[model samples]
Target chain A: AQRVTQPEKLLSVFKGAPVELKCNYSYSGSPELFWYVQYSRQRLQLLLRHISRESIKGFTADLNKGETSFHLKKPFAQEEDSAMYYCALRASGAGSYQLTFGKGTKLSVIP
Target chain B: DTAVSQTPKYLVTQMGNDKSIKCEQNLGHDTMYWYKQDSKKFLKIMFSYNNKELIINETVPNRFSPKSPDKAHLNLHINSLELGDSAVYFCASSPMVGGGGGDMDTQYFGPGTRLTVL
Candidate 1:
Protein backbone atom coordinates (compact mmCIF):
# COMPACT_ATOMS: atom_id res chain seq x y z
CA ALA A 1 0.00 0.00 0.00
CA GLN A 2 1.22 3.47 -0.86
CA ARG A 3 0.14 6.41 1.27
CA VAL A 4 1.15 10.07 1.35
CA THR A 5 1.01 12.10 4.53
CA GLN A 6 0.85 15.89 4.77
CA PRO A 7 0.51 16.57 8.47
CA GLU A 8 -0.12 20.27 8.40
CA LYS A 9 -3.55 21.42 7.34
CA LEU A 10 -2.59 25.07 7.46
CA LEU A 11 0.78 26.90 7.44
CA SER A 12 1.48 30.59 7.74
CA VAL A 13 4.66 32.47 6.93
CA PHE A 14 5.66 36.09 6.76
CA LYS A 15 6.65 37.68 3.46
CA GLY A 16 10.23 36.84 2.38
CA ALA A 17 10.35 34.07 4.98
CA PRO A 18 11.33 30.55 4.17
CA VAL A 19 8.63 27.95 3.57
CA GLU A 20 8.73 24.24 4.15
CA LEU A 21 5.75 21.96 3.63
CA LYS A 22 6.37 18.57 5.15
CA CYS A 23 5.39 15.37 3.35
CA ASN A 24 6.06 11.73 4.17
CA TYR A 25 5.11 8.55 2.41
CA SER A 26 4.86 4.82 3.03
CA TYR A 27 5.38 2.57 0.08
CA SER A 28 6.77 -0.88 -0.40
CA GLY A 29 8.50 -0.27 -3.72
CA SER A 30 10.23 2.67 -5.28
CA PRO A 31 7.78 5.51 -5.89
CA GLU A 32 7.80 8.72 -7.91
CA LEU A 33 6.97 11.77 -5.86
CA PHE A 34 5.36 14.99 -7.06
CA TRP A 35 4.16 18.30 -5.69
CA TYR A 36 0.97 19.95 -6.98
CA VAL A 37 -0.43 23.38 -6.31
CA GLN A 38 -3.92 24.79 -6.71
CA TYR A 39 -4.34 28.53 -6.68
CA SER A 40 -7.64 30.15 -5.75
CA ARG A 41 -10.23 29.74 -8.50
CA GLN A 42 -7.71 27.95 -10.68
CA ARG A 43 -7.18 24.35 -11.62
CA LEU A 44 -4.58 22.20 -9.97
CA GLN A 45 -1.19 22.26 -11.67
CA LEU A 46 1.98 20.33 -11.30
CA LEU A 47 4.67 22.14 -9.35
CA LEU A 48 7.61 19.78 -9.56
CA ARG A 49 8.49 16.14 -9.54
CA HIS A 50 11.42 14.46 -7.91
CA ILE A 51 12.34 12.76 -11.15
CA SER A 52 12.64 16.03 -13.04
CA ARG A 53 14.60 17.74 -10.27
CA GLU A 54 13.51 21.11 -11.60
CA SER A 55 12.22 24.18 -9.79
CA ILE A 56 8.91 25.76 -10.68
CA LYS A 57 7.85 29.22 -9.50
CA GLY A 58 10.59 29.12 -6.89
CA PHE A 59 9.32 25.84 -5.39
CA THR A 60 11.36 22.65 -5.24
CA ALA A 61 11.04 19.19 -3.71
CA ASP A 62 13.59 16.46 -3.21
CA LEU A 63 12.72 12.82 -2.72
CA ASN A 64 14.56 11.22 0.16
CA LYS A 65 14.00 7.51 -0.06
CA GLY A 66 15.75 6.74 3.21
CA GLU A 67 13.61 9.11 5.25
CA THR A 68 10.56 8.39 3.07
CA SER A 69 10.01 12.12 2.75
CA PHE A 70 9.61 14.50 -0.21
CA HIS A 71 9.17 17.83 1.51
CA LEU A 72 8.59 20.97 -0.59
CA LYS A 73 10.69 24.00 0.18
CA LYS A 74 11.14 27.60 -0.97
CA PRO A 75 13.72 30.18 -0.01
CA PHE A 76 11.31 33.13 0.20
CA ALA A 77 7.54 33.01 0.54
CA GLN A 78 5.37 35.24 -1.62
CA GLU A 79 1.71 36.14 -1.36
CA GLU A 80 0.99 34.54 -4.73
CA ASP A 81 2.41 31.27 -3.49
CA SER A 82 -0.49 30.94 -1.06
CA ALA A 83 -2.59 28.01 -2.16
CA MET A 84 -3.46 24.39 -1.50
CA TYR A 85 -0.45 22.10 -1.83
CA TYR A 86 -0.65 18.35 -2.25
CA CYS A 87 2.00 15.67 -2.21
CA ALA A 88 1.35 12.70 -4.46
CA LEU A 89 3.10 9.39 -5.02
CA ARG A 90 3.00 6.93 -7.89
CA ALA A 91 4.25 3.43 -7.49
CA SER A 92 6.97 2.02 -9.75
CA GLY A 93 5.73 -0.54 -12.26
CA ALA A 94 4.20 -0.90 -15.66
CA GLY A 95 0.59 0.31 -15.85
CA SER A 96 0.89 1.85 -12.38
CA TYR A 97 -0.27 5.32 -13.26
CA GLN A 98 -2.41 5.92 -10.24
CA LEU A 99 -1.42 8.85 -8.04
CA THR A 100 -2.09 8.57 -4.32
CA PHE A 101 -2.44 12.05 -2.88
CA GLY A 102 -2.22 13.41 0.65
CA LYS A 103 -4.83 15.42 2.50
CA GLY A 104 -3.09 18.67 1.39
CA THR A 105 -1.69 21.75 3.15
CA LYS A 106 -2.97 25.27 2.84
CA LEU A 107 -0.06 27.72 2.74
CA SER A 108 -0.69 31.35 3.61
CA VAL A 109 1.99 33.94 2.90
CA ILE A 110 1.36 37.19 4.73
CA PRO A 111 2.36 40.34 2.92
CA ASP B 1 -9.08 27.31 -24.78
CA THR B 2 -9.35 24.96 -21.85
CA ALA B 3 -7.41 21.73 -22.10
CA VAL B 4 -9.70 19.97 -19.64
CA SER B 5 -13.18 21.22 -18.86
CA GLN B 6 -16.20 20.06 -16.85
CA THR B 7 -19.77 21.20 -17.15
CA PRO B 8 -22.17 22.39 -14.40
CA LYS B 9 -19.55 24.19 -12.37
CA TYR B 10 -21.98 24.29 -9.43
CA LEU B 11 -24.86 21.98 -8.66
CA VAL B 12 -27.48 21.93 -5.87
CA THR B 13 -30.06 19.19 -5.68
CA GLN B 14 -32.26 17.25 -3.32
CA MET B 15 -31.53 13.81 -2.00
CA GLY B 16 -32.33 10.65 -4.01
CA ASN B 17 -32.07 12.59 -7.24
CA ASP B 18 -29.86 11.38 -10.04
CA LYS B 19 -27.41 13.75 -11.65
CA SER B 20 -24.56 13.62 -14.10
CA ILE B 21 -21.35 15.62 -14.35
CA LYS B 22 -19.83 15.95 -17.79
CA CYS B 23 -16.13 16.22 -18.53
CA GLU B 24 -14.24 16.69 -21.78
CA GLN B 25 -10.62 17.17 -22.67
CA ASN B 26 -9.31 18.82 -25.79
CA LEU B 27 -5.73 17.82 -25.22
CA GLY B 28 -6.17 14.64 -27.30
CA HIS B 29 -4.88 12.51 -24.51
CA ASP B 30 -5.65 8.82 -24.20
CA THR B 31 -6.37 8.74 -20.47
CA MET B 32 -8.96 10.48 -18.31
CA TYR B 33 -9.72 10.44 -14.60
CA TRP B 34 -12.30 11.42 -12.03
CA TYR B 35 -11.36 12.53 -8.53
CA LYS B 36 -13.38 13.58 -5.52
CA GLN B 37 -12.28 16.21 -3.04
CA ASP B 38 -14.04 16.03 0.29
CA SER B 39 -14.79 18.95 2.58
CA LYS B 40 -11.53 18.31 4.36
CA LYS B 41 -9.76 18.84 1.02
CA PHE B 42 -8.81 15.20 0.74
CA LEU B 43 -8.58 14.23 -2.93
CA LYS B 44 -9.09 10.61 -3.94
CA ILE B 45 -9.26 8.87 -7.26
CA MET B 46 -12.62 7.45 -8.19
CA PHE B 47 -12.23 6.19 -11.74
CA SER B 48 -9.86 6.20 -14.68
CA TYR B 49 -10.36 5.49 -18.37
CA ASN B 50 -7.83 4.96 -21.10
CA ASN B 51 -8.77 5.09 -24.73
CA LYS B 52 -12.45 4.62 -23.92
CA GLU B 53 -11.68 1.62 -21.79
CA LEU B 54 -12.16 1.26 -18.05
CA ILE B 55 -8.64 0.96 -16.77
CA ILE B 56 -8.76 1.87 -13.08
CA ASN B 57 -11.74 1.79 -10.76
CA GLU B 58 -11.29 2.48 -7.08
CA THR B 59 -13.38 1.37 -4.10
CA VAL B 60 -16.28 3.57 -4.97
CA PRO B 61 -19.95 2.89 -4.50
CA ASN B 62 -22.06 1.30 -7.24
CA ARG B 63 -24.25 4.37 -7.30
CA PHE B 64 -21.34 6.24 -8.77
CA SER B 65 -20.94 5.18 -12.38
CA PRO B 66 -18.50 6.58 -14.94
CA LYS B 67 -18.99 6.44 -18.68
CA SER B 68 -16.60 7.15 -21.49
CA PRO B 69 -18.30 7.51 -24.82
CA ASP B 70 -15.08 8.47 -26.52
CA LYS B 71 -11.48 9.01 -25.75
CA ALA B 72 -11.99 12.67 -24.97
CA HIS B 73 -15.20 12.58 -22.95
CA LEU B 74 -15.84 11.06 -19.53
CA ASN B 75 -19.04 11.49 -17.60
CA LEU B 76 -19.89 10.59 -14.02
CA HIS B 77 -23.45 9.77 -13.00
CA ILE B 78 -24.54 9.35 -9.42
CA ASN B 79 -27.82 7.64 -8.56
CA SER B 80 -29.81 8.03 -5.36
CA LEU B 81 -27.48 10.71 -4.23
CA GLU B 82 -26.74 11.02 -0.55
CA LEU B 83 -25.60 13.93 1.54
CA GLY B 84 -22.20 12.33 1.77
CA ASP B 85 -21.90 12.71 -1.98
CA SER B 86 -21.74 16.47 -1.74
CA ALA B 87 -18.21 17.45 -2.68
CA VAL B 88 -16.09 18.84 -5.48
CA TYR B 89 -15.55 16.56 -8.46
CA PHE B 90 -12.56 17.07 -10.72
CA CYS B 91 -11.74 15.69 -14.16
CA ALA B 92 -8.22 15.26 -15.42
CA SER B 93 -6.38 13.89 -18.44
CA SER B 94 -2.92 12.72 -19.27
CA PRO B 95 -0.93 11.00 -21.98
CA MET B 96 -0.31 7.27 -21.97
CA VAL B 97 2.30 5.78 -19.70
CA GLY B 98 5.60 5.84 -21.51
CA GLY B 99 8.89 4.12 -20.82
CA GLY B 100 10.43 6.63 -18.40
CA GLY B 101 11.97 10.10 -17.91
CA GLY B 102 9.24 11.99 -19.70
CA ASP B 103 5.94 13.75 -19.10
CA MET B 104 4.03 10.53 -19.44
CA ASP B 105 2.12 10.41 -16.15
CA THR B 106 1.72 14.13 -15.69
CA GLN B 107 -2.00 14.90 -15.53
CA TYR B 108 -3.72 18.14 -16.52
CA PHE B 109 -6.76 18.90 -14.39
CA GLY B 110 -10.07 20.55 -15.15
CA PRO B 111 -11.65 23.44 -13.29
CA GLY B 112 -13.76 21.01 -11.24
CA THR B 113 -17.47 20.98 -10.47
CA ARG B 114 -18.87 21.74 -7.06
CA LEU B 115 -21.82 19.48 -6.30
CA THR B 116 -24.11 20.26 -3.41
CA VAL B 117 -26.57 17.57 -2.37
CA LEU B 118 -29.17 19.21 -0.18
Candidate 2:
Protein backbone atom coordinates (compact mmCIF):
# COMPACT_ATOMS: atom_id res chain seq x y z
CA ALA A 1 0.00 0.00 0.00
CA GLN A 2 1.15 3.51 -0.76
CA ARG A 3 1.59 5.68 2.32
CA VAL A 4 3.12 8.96 3.50
CA THR A 5 4.97 9.02 6.78
CA GLN A 6 5.91 12.13 8.67
CA PRO A 7 8.15 10.97 11.46
CA GLU A 8 8.03 14.14 13.49
CA LYS A 9 4.89 15.20 15.31
CA LEU A 10 6.47 18.27 16.85
CA LEU A 11 9.58 20.30 16.05
CA SER A 12 10.84 23.45 17.78
CA VAL A 13 13.58 25.82 16.64
CA PHE A 14 14.97 29.29 17.16
CA LYS A 15 14.18 32.17 14.87
CA GLY A 16 17.37 31.87 12.82
CA ALA A 17 17.94 28.16 13.16
CA PRO A 18 17.72 25.73 10.29
CA VAL A 19 14.60 23.62 10.07
CA GLU A 20 14.05 20.22 8.55
CA LEU A 21 10.84 18.14 8.52
CA LYS A 22 11.46 14.55 7.50
CA CYS A 23 9.05 12.63 5.26
CA ASN A 24 9.30 9.10 3.93
CA TYR A 25 6.97 7.21 1.61
CA SER A 26 6.21 3.60 0.80
CA TYR A 27 5.20 3.01 -2.79
CA SER A 28 6.20 0.67 -5.60
CA GLY A 29 5.81 3.13 -8.41
CA SER A 30 6.95 6.72 -8.68
CA PRO A 31 4.44 8.97 -6.94
CA GLU A 32 3.81 12.69 -6.73
CA LEU A 33 4.72 14.26 -3.37
CA PHE A 34 3.48 17.48 -1.83
CA TRP A 35 3.79 19.53 1.38
CA TYR A 36 0.75 21.30 2.77
CA VAL A 37 0.88 23.84 5.58
CA GLN A 38 -1.95 24.86 7.85
CA TYR A 39 -1.41 27.94 9.98
CA SER A 40 -3.32 28.60 13.16
CA ARG A 41 -6.98 29.27 12.41
CA GLN A 42 -6.31 29.11 8.67
CA ARG A 43 -7.10 26.63 5.94
CA LEU A 44 -4.57 24.10 4.78
CA GLN A 45 -2.62 25.40 1.79
CA LEU A 46 -0.06 24.00 -0.58
CA LEU A 47 3.49 24.86 0.44
CA LEU A 48 5.51 23.07 -2.22
CA ARG A 49 5.76 19.98 -4.41
CA HIS A 50 8.59 17.78 -5.57
CA ILE A 51 8.07 18.43 -9.28
CA SER A 52 7.88 22.17 -8.90
CA ARG A 53 11.44 22.29 -7.51
CA GLU A 54 10.56 25.77 -6.33
CA SER A 55 10.74 27.26 -2.87
CA ILE A 56 7.78 28.87 -1.16
CA LYS A 57 7.88 31.10 1.89
CA GLY A 58 11.56 30.24 2.26
CA PHE A 59 10.77 26.52 2.41
CA THR A 60 12.09 23.97 -0.09
CA ALA A 61 11.74 20.23 -0.51
CA ASP A 62 13.84 17.85 -2.56
CA LEU A 63 12.66 14.48 -3.78
CA ASN A 64 15.18 11.70 -3.22
CA LYS A 65 13.95 8.80 -5.28
CA GLY A 66 16.68 6.48 -4.07
CA GLU A 67 15.80 7.15 -0.45
CA THR A 68 12.09 7.32 -1.18
CA SER A 69 11.94 10.57 0.72
CA PHE A 70 10.69 14.13 0.15
CA HIS A 71 11.91 16.17 3.08
CA LEU A 72 10.91 19.79 3.66
CA LYS A 73 13.70 22.23 4.59
CA LYS A 74 14.32 25.82 5.35
CA PRO A 75 17.73 27.40 5.94
CA PHE A 76 16.43 29.98 8.38
CA ALA A 77 13.26 29.55 10.35
CA GLN A 78 11.12 32.50 11.30
CA GLU A 79 8.50 32.89 13.97
CA GLU A 80 5.87 33.38 11.31
CA ASP A 81 6.78 30.01 9.83
CA SER A 82 5.30 28.15 12.75
CA ALA A 83 2.37 26.00 11.66
CA MET A 84 1.17 22.46 11.05
CA TYR A 85 2.76 20.74 8.05
CA TYR A 86 1.42 17.67 6.33
CA CYS A 87 3.16 15.41 3.86
CA ALA A 88 1.00 13.95 1.10
CA LEU A 89 1.47 11.45 -1.70
CA ARG A 90 -0.49 10.70 -4.87
CA ALA A 91 -0.17 7.46 -6.75
CA SER A 92 -2.01 5.27 -9.27
CA GLY A 93 -3.30 3.22 -6.39
CA ALA A 94 -6.96 2.78 -5.43
CA GLY A 95 -7.25 6.46 -4.54
CA SER A 96 -6.17 8.16 -7.76
CA TYR A 97 -7.30 11.74 -7.40
CA GLN A 98 -7.27 11.69 -3.63
CA LEU A 99 -4.01 12.13 -1.73
CA THR A 100 -2.78 10.09 1.21
CA PHE A 101 -1.68 12.47 3.95
CA GLY A 102 0.51 11.90 6.98
CA LYS A 103 -0.53 12.75 10.49
CA GLY A 104 1.40 16.05 10.23
CA THR A 105 4.14 17.89 12.14
CA LYS A 106 3.64 20.92 14.33
CA LEU A 107 6.50 23.40 13.79
CA SER A 108 7.21 26.08 16.30
CA VAL A 109 9.82 28.77 15.85
CA ILE A 110 10.74 30.69 18.98
CA PRO A 111 11.90 34.28 18.82
CA ASP B 1 -13.10 35.10 -4.68
CA THR B 2 -12.90 31.75 -2.98
CA ALA B 3 -11.75 29.09 -5.46
CA VAL B 4 -13.14 26.27 -3.35
CA SER B 5 -15.80 26.87 -0.68
CA GLN B 6 -17.78 24.71 1.74
CA THR B 7 -20.95 25.68 3.53
CA PRO B 8 -21.53 25.60 7.34
CA LYS B 9 -18.05 26.54 8.52
CA TYR B 10 -19.07 24.94 11.79
CA LEU B 11 -21.77 22.35 12.44
CA VAL B 12 -22.77 21.07 15.87
CA THR B 13 -25.49 18.48 16.00
CA GLN B 14 -26.61 15.46 17.96
CA MET B 15 -25.77 11.95 16.92
CA GLY B 16 -28.24 10.06 14.69
CA ASN B 17 -29.18 13.31 12.95
CA ASP B 18 -28.90 13.75 9.20
CA LYS B 19 -26.85 16.61 7.81
CA SER B 20 -25.32 17.80 4.57
CA ILE B 21 -22.23 19.81 3.75
CA LYS B 22 -22.16 21.57 0.40
CA CYS B 23 -18.99 22.32 -1.54
CA GLU B 24 -18.37 24.34 -4.70
CA GLN B 25 -15.30 25.39 -6.65
CA ASN B 26 -15.08 28.35 -8.99
CA LEU B 27 -11.68 27.48 -10.39
CA GLY B 28 -13.32 25.40 -13.12
CA HIS B 29 -11.21 22.42 -12.17
CA ASP B 30 -12.32 19.02 -13.31
CA THR B 31 -11.65 17.26 -10.00
CA MET B 32 -12.88 17.72 -6.42
CA TYR B 33 -12.29 15.88 -3.16
CA TRP B 34 -13.38 15.53 0.44
CA TYR B 35 -11.02 14.90 3.32
CA LYS B 36 -11.68 14.29 6.99
CA GLN B 37 -9.31 15.37 9.76
CA ASP B 38 -9.92 13.47 12.92
CA SER B 39 -9.39 14.70 16.47
CA LYS B 40 -5.91 13.25 16.42
CA LYS B 41 -5.18 15.54 13.46
CA PHE B 42 -4.84 12.63 11.07
CA LEU B 43 -6.22 13.46 7.64
CA LYS B 44 -7.85 10.88 5.38
CA ILE B 45 -9.48 10.95 1.99
CA MET B 46 -13.18 10.27 1.94
CA PHE B 47 -14.13 10.79 -1.71
CA SER B 48 -13.13 12.30 -5.01
CA TYR B 49 -15.18 13.43 -8.01
CA ASN B 50 -14.01 14.15 -11.53
CA ASN B 51 -16.21 15.95 -14.03
CA LYS B 52 -19.25 15.27 -11.86
CA GLU B 53 -18.36 11.56 -11.79
CA LEU B 54 -17.23 9.60 -8.79
CA ILE B 55 -13.71 8.32 -9.28
CA ILE B 56 -12.38 7.59 -5.82
CA ASN B 57 -14.24 6.48 -2.72
CA GLU B 58 -12.28 5.57 0.36
CA THR B 59 -13.24 3.11 3.07
CA VAL B 60 -15.80 5.53 4.43
CA PRO B 61 -18.99 4.15 5.92
CA ASN B 62 -22.07 3.75 3.71
CA ARG B 63 -23.87 6.23 5.92
CA PHE B 64 -21.75 8.92 4.24
CA SER B 65 -22.55 9.70 0.61
CA PRO B 66 -21.12 12.23 -1.82
CA LYS B 67 -23.22 13.82 -4.53
CA SER B 68 -21.94 15.85 -7.41
CA PRO B 69 -24.76 17.49 -9.32
CA ASP B 70 -22.38 19.25 -11.70
CA LYS B 71 -18.66 19.54 -12.28
CA ALA B 72 -18.44 22.57 -10.04
CA HIS B 73 -20.35 21.29 -7.03
CA LEU B 74 -20.00 18.29 -4.74
CA ASN B 75 -21.96 17.75 -1.56
CA LEU B 76 -21.53 15.28 1.31
CA HIS B 77 -24.51 13.94 3.19
CA ILE B 78 -24.28 11.84 6.32
CA ASN B 79 -27.18 9.66 7.37
CA SER B 80 -27.44 8.93 11.06
CA LEU B 81 -24.29 10.67 11.94
CA GLU B 82 -22.17 9.12 14.64
CA LEU B 83 -19.85 10.59 17.24
CA GLY B 84 -16.90 9.35 15.20
CA ASP B 85 -17.95 11.73 12.42
CA SER B 86 -16.94 14.67 14.55
CA ALA B 87 -14.03 16.21 12.72
CA VAL B 88 -13.00 18.94 10.35
CA TYR B 89 -14.01 18.23 6.75
CA PHE B 90 -12.12 19.89 3.94
CA CYS B 91 -13.14 20.37 0.32
CA ALA B 92 -10.47 20.62 -2.33
CA SER B 93 -9.97 20.84 -6.11
CA SER B 94 -7.36 20.17 -8.74
CA PRO B 95 -6.91 20.75 -12.46
CA MET B 96 -7.71 17.27 -13.81
CA VAL B 97 -6.50 13.73 -14.12
CA GLY B 98 -3.32 12.84 -16.04
CA GLY B 99 -2.46 16.52 -16.41
CA GLY B 100 0.98 16.79 -14.87
CA GLY B 101 2.73 20.11 -14.35
CA GLY B 102 3.32 19.89 -10.62
CA ASP B 103 0.41 22.26 -10.23
CA MET B 104 -2.03 19.48 -11.08
CA ASP B 105 -1.14 17.70 -7.88
CA THR B 106 -1.45 20.88 -5.83
CA GLN B 107 -4.96 20.80 -4.38
CA TYR B 108 -6.52 24.02 -3.11
CA PHE B 109 -8.31 23.41 0.20
CA GLY B 110 -11.26 25.29 1.60
CA PRO B 111 -11.46 26.87 5.05
CA GLY B 112 -12.81 23.52 6.30
CA THR B 113 -16.06 22.72 8.10
CA ARG B 114 -15.70 21.70 11.74
CA LEU B 115 -18.43 19.18 12.54
CA THR B 116 -19.04 18.40 16.18
CA VAL B 117 -21.33 15.54 17.13
CA LEU B 118 -22.66 15.07 20.60
DockQ of all models, two decimals each: 0.70, 0.65
Give all candidates' CA lDDT scores: 0.93, 0.91
Q: Write the per-residue lDDT of candidate 1 for residues B1-118, one digit (tens) a residue.
A: 8589999999999999999999999988999999999999899999999999998899999999999999999999999999999999999998874335348889899999999999
Going through the candidates in order, what is the number of backbone clashes in each? Answer: 0, 0
lDDT tens digits by residue: candidate 2, B39-102: 8889898999999899888899999999999999999999999999999999999988656547
True contacts kept of each: 0.60, 0.76
Interface RMSD of each: 1.4, 2.7
Q: lDDT tens digits, residues A61-82, model 2? A: 9999999999999999999999
Model 1, residue pairs in steric clash:
none
lDDT of 2 at B1: 84
